[model samples]
Target: GAGVSQSPRYKVAKRGQDVALRCDPISGHVSLFWYQQALGQGPEFLTYFQNEAQLDKSGLPSDRFFAERPEGSVSTLKIQRTQQEDSAVYLCASSLSFSPGMDEQFFGPGTRLTVL
Candidate 1:
């Protein structure tokens, strides 16, 4: 079975541009999550989805961030009005269960976003 995967491993954007990142989770996984990591910092949770339902998005830094899992497997994270402060690695993870703290999350190689 395939593990989580992300696209466009690297991106360079000018400030104020918008970017979209994609994620493909392992088959049959029930939960998906997005995270943001600044340089030299640990990844911070950004949002969570159970199947196709978005359950939490409290960690998104601002309204510029958005995420969705419309079909319960593939997910997307969109960042609008990119800022230099938003330059970082965006990670995607998936688990077999919805219990975030208990279930082991499999992480994909992150997509590094650079805002010039």
Candidate 2:
């Protein structure tokens, strides 16, 4: 894809359910980031992957939230034991270089996860 692509644009998960959201970034991008946005709030950083290495995950809300970029192009964010508070939009963004904050990050449409 020429741009970042996220699968399952919308997802409904029952309480305690597990969900995995996928992200396919623009080819050859060097940085990928995962974020969670609650209702009306801004996106909060969840993790960051530079190439195939997960260099930062300090923003993950809990142990139940996990993300990975195995091949440096595609990534997945997995949520375990879904709860009402977990209902939010999971966003994926990719940048051309390692400095995502300074580079222009191409964002996906995001995967909205609704936990009921």
Candidate 3:
């Protein structure tokens, strides 16, 4: 099975533009996570999904940010009306456990979004 992978590793977006980042996690992993990492900081949790159900989205910065894992495999993070503050590395992670935080997560390379 493939490890976690993110597409368009780098994205340059104009302010107010909407961007969609993709993530492909390891096969059979039941838990998925989305995070935002700013310069010199650690990844901050954005959302979590178990199977096809979104279990938590408490860490999303605002309503402009949304994530989904519709089929329990591939996931997407969509940012609408992107602001300069939205510039960051968007990372996707997955784990074998049904409970996300309970297990060690394997992270993807991340799609870095640069808001101009």
**Which candidate's TM-score is highest?**
1
Point out where model 3 deviates above 4 Å. Answer: 99-101
For candidate 1, lDDT tens digit of each residue in 1-116? 67899998999999999999999999999999999999999999999999999999999999999998999999999999999999999999999997637689999999999999
- Spell out the clash pairs found in candidate 1: none
Residue 77 in model 1: lDDT? 98
Best by lDDT: 1
In the range 46-115, model 2's lDDT, one tens digit per residue, is 9999999999999998999989888888999999999999999999999999752588989999999999
Q: TM per model?
A: 0.96, 0.95, 0.95
Q: Please list the Cα RMSD from the true structure of every candidate, rounded to 1 decimal place.
A: 1.1, 1.4, 1.4
What 10-residue stretch in candidate 1 is worst by lDDT?
Answer: 96-105
Better of 1 and 3 by lDDT: 1
